[model samples]
Target: MDHKALSAHQAMLGTEVSRRRLLQLAALSVAGTALTGAPAHAAPPADKHTYRLTVLGTTDTHGNVFNWDYFKDAEYTDSANNDIGLAKISTLVAAMREERGAENCLLLDAGDTIQGTPLSYYYAKIDPITGGHVHPMAAAMNAIGYDAAAMGNHEFNYGLDVLDTFDRQLNFPLLCANAVDWHTDEPVYQPYSLHTVNPEGGRKITVGVLGLVTPGVAIWDKAVVDGKVRFPGIVEQAKVFVPQMRAAGADIVIVSCHSGPNTSSSYGDALPYPENASTLLAEEVPGIDAILVGHAHLEIPQRFVTNKQTGKQVLLSEPLRWGMRLTVMDLDLVKVRGRWQVAAMGAHLLNANTVPEDPAIAAILTGDHATVRRYVNSVIGTSAAAMSAATARYEDTAAMDFVNHVQSAEVARALAGTPEAALPILSISAPFNKDATVPAGAVTVRDVAGMYIFDNTLLGIVLTGEQVRAYLEFSARYFKQVTGAGPFAPADVTNAVTDTAPNGTPDYNYDTMAGYTERLTYDIDIAHPVGARIKNLRYGDDLIDPAQRFVIAINNYRQSGGGNFPGVTTAPVVYNAQREIRQLIIDWVSEQGQIDPSSFSTTDWKLTANDVPVVIQA
Candidate 1:
């Protein structure tokens, strides 16, 4: 049943007398209509018997077919490389299938199959999947035998046409009840699929799987799917589809949701766009035997949510990201009369790092992997001095300076003829890769790509000095308040450690403002309730006035309100090149031939307190 129907059902159950009498009367009616005057509780034929079934899932693979880091041009081997690729996951899947019995297993994915790493970008933009080249991710997933997959937000990055190509090539169904045609409100892809499986000497079981993508896709992918496709809320769509699946004779219903379990809702009740509502989905929707959660990149191996209506615990699991973990949900069902019901359910996650890479699968994608490696390793330019973003999160580094400088220069060129050209231009960038580095001798496409991981485009916006201060205030939320501190550590300055996954904001949200001469002393106490962390803010030696207007360069993600940055998305957009920032950096270095270290280098922001020395993380 859908969320609303399920809610009414729970309310009916609360009135025990009414509910019990209603069931009793229905049973009497059924018995009265029996052909052979059989009892209401008569057992069904032996063919309709109890059986065990297993559900396995993976999410946010991000197109990693091999356990290799294309950006680093090395084998992905480290604790950080836990469950790095599909090859390793293939091995685990084999072992899991053997243990669970292949006949009883149904394999699935939670979306985000493509987009991430040099390999994915190479195929999407460089090779172009429509150019008669099969995407390695699609090929690898098909080989692994995925029964069904959900729609991830990133799947729309290269546009629907590209997604359609992958969809055409896949052997499994790509389900998304929420991604629908705006006018008709009908799903653009398969909303749900019913998989009929037969265990050894057991009755045929119909397992219904429904897929839902986060409604945040409407905002994140506005450029591509705006007028053609619309994304409705997860709970809203789940409320509609679950009941249909049950009516279609499904014994067990599973939701492969590309969302997290965050308590707060971004869209709220006003719009059908809750970014993370997996918890709400399980609690509100009835007949949901299991949920495979994704998109938050969390490592929740297993969780059981108690359905308020039935008081039955429903299994939920998320396998982190990048093929790191696999969630396996084992269920036992019993046939009562003619209907099958879930008797017992359990779930857990298997780490991909524990197994070796599947050689057969690796061999299939070797040629494509080598092609990407060669492209990334091609030398682009030379750096006069060594640069590193290893400490960029805690301090200003040459690595970030390189990005800001390139962005500012290009944005200035793009805005040369615009009315905002005369205004003071500033660039804002975040340290995407803390471990990225460029040696003094030479730089390759890999070095540039390592510094900027996302496929975000550059955008220029106009903002007043007051709005700028408000922007900085919102970013200051990254820091944790420290009172009466004699000596302060990075933990004292930021809550990076305590922030849990699916709810925690990453370090990338803490933006670093560049191009302007400013000092942020981190005077958090200046405003009693925190958030006022910047002090003595200056733009080229003069204190910034609240009335002054300036043009700022930022990525399209921030311009579209990816981090909820203040005054960014709402601010008047001055320039939109729609060009990828990473590609711009690659082109800039290729043209420059040599990058001088001093061209864009400085330490602009710092943490301070009343006679307290702040120690940042390394």
Candidate 2:
């Protein structure tokens, strides 16, 4: 490729460029323009010199085989509606295969495929894959004809047996070079796969795909994955595999890494574990053509990393989570001395909403979909009053109260006869679903599942009053500082930062405490920055004593250093109920046979701007 062609290719690699513009440039490169108005016929015989290889990938599908949110019991159609699922992805896969001939195309996944929705939960727990039924995730991806898949962190949520079931059922290899069997010091799964494809009249091209997963699995899913398998760093694993793949005669090398791009080592240490190492892998690993990234759940269409040693830019793309986007990478390769070399490459994302859901996919998974729908829609109990999370973020609402009450009660019960029984208990929870609600009638499992979507287990951590106040202060950062004393929209109180952390705080991290009785008046002083937002922190009638110790109810995620909340992960553990929090809520509500909201406080916190009352928008 000439300098002008290289420049145009670089322009296409620019992550900030819109997909439309990238596609336009891709069209120019597809022709023999090379950034110049050159005719295609002027180039050498197309078949003899060049081969166009299209790489299509999906990441974080999370078992959304149908374009429906099982929790909502509705078709996932839009941002407002619940319609994002792999059924929509199936359409894209078929179209991409047809657009770029299936012979020259590769379909891959970056992982987090097996665990997200009620459908996945139902299959993993209810009708387990181990019990004869094929795992829905593997079945769906196999139906779509995936080339290979990496193991995501969530893949280990159900333990090695469940992961093995899904892995065994898949038609393609579930690649994870980093996850190894400690006893033998070898990968439990295949380190990589070599895919040889033959386009019409084109030379055979061998594409090497190496997969790597985040090493943080040893921390997040330590209880399950620990001692069973060891997770090594992506860069460390890549160095070993790239040479092996090269020696194995791979023409083009691609990494299916189930991790985001993070420069920092995992937990701020250089112990071979990095939460995200796609960028580092690209920079450190040589002979890599492209990388498919996931785990962050952000829409990163394309990113280019300049290798520190060779200074060659490696292409990286991360399609947004939940089957929302499909990343496409078109590699312009040329035959050189009987071997194919990548000449120019461009990648872009296609949204699921761009095409209709594949009817064939819907037809294939109808039985599983119906099973989950029937299970989730069954009425488990009733509520005396409707509970809404619409105002839960700005004010204390019954949505959180219900979760906190169940959590606190479960913790107190779990601590019976334990030394921690003497400590006062408090429960901390966050509004996971802002639009969640339960009417004053029958409450189905879906209604409760919508309120608590995550499959987090309950844990009790011992924290001091000072630490509690600090936790609240961190939670209060969710609100943007109100400079003037005036009425503001409820939604406007949120900080202007996006959810992808290392930059912005996610709403899920903003936890609400149940045992403390204090008002979090919206009186955010603009003068005070982060870590100093909460005020009038008290428990009961008197101000909280900084030294007073309390046992707080928390989910396993918070206790496992998720969300980076202070004094929570490091706090002494009083009790660890290896029970899903959602199940606890279901059991508590089912036992009561009703959800009573009258006793739940709706105003544990208030918002005021510098002593002036602020009116909340409806």
Candidate 3:
């Protein structure tokens, strides 16, 4: 390979030269005699020593095998009409392999493979792969022929036993460089994988793929992984392993990072390291040619960041979550001094909606899919009145209250006859899915499950009245400040994009509080600054006492510091039995045989602008 050509290419890209400017420069260099009437030299022929290697990546598949939604009992459809599932992605992978030559292509995933849909939940909680049942994700990925995958934070949701079972069923390795044994300080999973691609007539290319997951897992899944495994910083691990991969004769290095490119952590300072550190990893480390980013659930077709130490640009891409998109990275490698060196690289995303589901993948998981479908569709109870969470983020709704009612009741029952039993009990509920609804009559397990999408467990934490107010203020940051109460659309006021939430606060982060034996009420004064948003916070009929202690029914995710909410992580845990909150809701409905919203529903909270109730139009 010519060093001059590589240098010029990098310089052009560094200067942000446009395609037209590049074409003009090429014409001027190639047609030397056009202006001077001198003898013209022809352009050099294509390099035979150059090879194109295509790597396909997917992240946050989240147990989706088919394009069907078990909760809705129909095909999944979002506002964007984007198709999902590994079956759809399988077709795209097949075409790429065929087009690029199967020997020249590699497939990878950035994790969050299990525990999203009812399909994954059924397998993890009901049949359980630990009991010798094959994980649908493992079966589908094995059929599609994956080279490797990273371990996502959610992979630890079901504990190490389940993760190990899924890992054993995979045809490829599950890599995570930062997840190390607590006592041994040694990597628990494979750090990196090496693949040798032989170009038809050129030198074989040794592609080294390293996987790293967010250290936030240490805090998010502390209950399941504490003392057993610990997650170090992503960049910290990459710096140690990239050198080893180079020493092992790797010509090109690629990272499948389960962290996002953004340098932010939702868990605050709980951990010393940043949760999403892909950008930091590329900038601080050398020898990394590209990275497949994940966990942010955002689509980034292509992004290039310059390495501070090497001054070489590193390519990064993150396909949207749930197999909605697939990232394709193409690397142009040239044989330099008898070794293949990466000369150029770029990536783009392919929408799963562009292709149909691969029959082979669908056929492979049909039985598992059917079983989950039946499980979710089973009738659990009946709802006298229909309830929807469409306005839960901006206003109080019965749908969300139902979640709090069941959670608080369970926590209260557990704390019965205990020292804290006399304390006022409150429960926090977040609008997980805006589309979740409990239709009038015939409430199935799916209806209840759809409301609480996460597999979070129930937990009871003690928080002071002052801390509770602070928590509500932090959650109020989800709304944008406004003056007039003149009918505003929900989208116009909610999910305020700010420094913390560059893409806007997700629905799961905005929580509303509900009382168990008393009425806990507050007003989110969106007309004021964030810290002063929670006004008129009260317990029962009087203003809340600053020093008053209360037991709050919370989820394991929040109590574990998943959302960086104030005071929860340090709060005293009163109860934690590792009980799934979703199942509790199911059981609550089954035991009662009816969901009467009037029994638990109350207009306890509302959004207000300058003490004037805000009217949010749907």
Candidate 4:
């Protein structure tokens, strides 16, 4: 779920009456008043069921064998370290089963089960040499058990053939409803999976699990997918399929949606940025009793979501990303007037610290520890010193530096070190990967993966030194203004308390930037657009030199036009998505023989003074 979109959505739900206004603008679906990008559906009665369905799920496990291995307690103490593995998960599963009863509890996972962590890596590449490519995830999942799961964007990382291998290895079934092969209107996936469990005496209870992945995935990973797959409109698919599931034999339809909302919205429906949630889908498709959401990795404890459009409540559980938390949702199934329905539901996260890991499950974890260590320790390449990721201290982090290096190097490699490489490569990447910060140490596979965690494709944007300054100025507003005493940020940017000084968000701390770079947070002139957010900037080392022409290399989307960032549309793109950062790193290492840490880290940021920071107050 994209929490970033929730703030704006809350403001739109109330203005639903003029929904017909959208029909005049562009594409509109008004099965019910389509609130902007929101879907339509009727409200479910509050008192419809007597029994509660307790569904617990995990997503983006990324082969997290145990809890957060990154945290070594307060002092890097191994004894104090808490591991997140199936061992701990089993405990949560057992407790939920005991508390909610097996008949009503549904355990699930949301996907990205293939890559990210060393464990998955071990199975993908390493395990093939010793044991087998058969991923241990199936065995691990079979231990704790999962009711249903959906496909995530990362599931396609190794390509469809490998994904099919993973599916064959899984103990549970894969659920996907939206992906199609284009030529064959035949479903790209199973569409939905139905489960029958006893909630009452000889009662037939069916749960239809539906899956959907982001449509942008094709753009993000165009290299392997190769336009072979088509992602159908999620809302349209639900309208067509959920009814089919209901007609088939499903009494309770649960959407194991890979889409979800970030928070509460008064908006008729939530757009949730990039992806829409089950709330929007629920309104468009009926018979869905609950939604188990994944993608965008945000955990929501209040599993019950009230639809802003229909006024009906639907059970929603999202454990965010990774195996960081476990969500348990209890659904009560009961016979109401000859029809069986969800009577009750509740959701909770297993905080790893709260309970002892089940020993049997621990043994399975212990069993795999040696193999995992061997895979991680296999050494992609040995670095003499520490290679770090981008830090809050300097915005030009190791991650950004590496990303820029990859994009620029690709341009350099493609152009083969010609005068074209002299264009002064400027790369832009999001600074928001959960694992963007890498520690200074012996570089390992996990360290590399963590630093470049985002699916963001490395992009190169061409800007003369003059226009670059304006872009810098726009990004600088995120910095904090230092009063006589200290710096301050907006409350929205920080968790800290605000005073007359202001709050502290990461963007507010422009002072953390390096010295060579002038902090753009301050506006020197009150009325001028130049030197602000890429304001009418010229293309030259010397702004007067119109003769200077440079080619920019960005991702396929930004090159074709995205981000609404101007000049980018007119900007020339010299590269495709084929050159990936990870692959580039692998190639870089392959050439270096042994990676020297010094080769990777660089002092990319330098600060400039005499510049006035922004003058915004809390």
Count of backbone clashes, every candidate in sequence: 0, 9, 0, 49
lDDT of 3: 0.85
Residues 1-618, model 1: lDDT tens digits: 011122112111122233234333322322212111222123322344766677888999998888888878887866564648987677666666655566778999999988998999998999989886888888778777789999899999888889999888787899999998989999999999999987556667899999999887887777788799999889889989999999998988999999986644333332346688898888888889899999888877667788877887787888888987777676767778777777776666766665567665776678898899999999999999999888776567888888888888887888778787787777888878876888898999998899999988888898888888788776666666665443555545653322222344477787877763333222333122345567767676677788988888888777776766778767888888788999999999999999887877877666555434455543
Ranking of predictions according to TM-score: 3, 1, 2, 4
After superposition, candidate 2 runs with Cα above 4 Å error: 1-45, 80-83, 182-185, 199-203, 262-272, 495-503, 516-527, 611-618
Highest lDDT against the true fold, candidate: 3
* C-alpha local distance difference test of each model: 0.76, 0.76, 0.85, 0.52
Better of 2 and 3 by TM-score: 3
Native-referenced Cα lDDT, model 4: 0.52
lDDT of 4 at 130: 28
Which segments of candidate 1 are over 4 A away from where they belong? 1-48, 265-272, 484-489, 496-503, 516-529, 611-613
The TM-score, computed over Cα atoms with residue i paired to residue i, of candidate 3 is 0.92
Model 1 — which ten-residue stretch has the worst lDDT?
1-10
- Per-model TM-score on C-alpha atoms: 0.88, 0.88, 0.92, 0.71
Tens-digit lDDT track of model 4 for 491-580: 322222222112222322131111111111212221223234223233222232334444444554333323223355444455554554
lDDT measured at residue 488 in model 3 versus the true structure, 0 to 100: 96
> lDDT by residue for model 3 over 233-308, one digit each (tens)?
9999999999999999899999999998888888778889998899999999999999999999988877889999
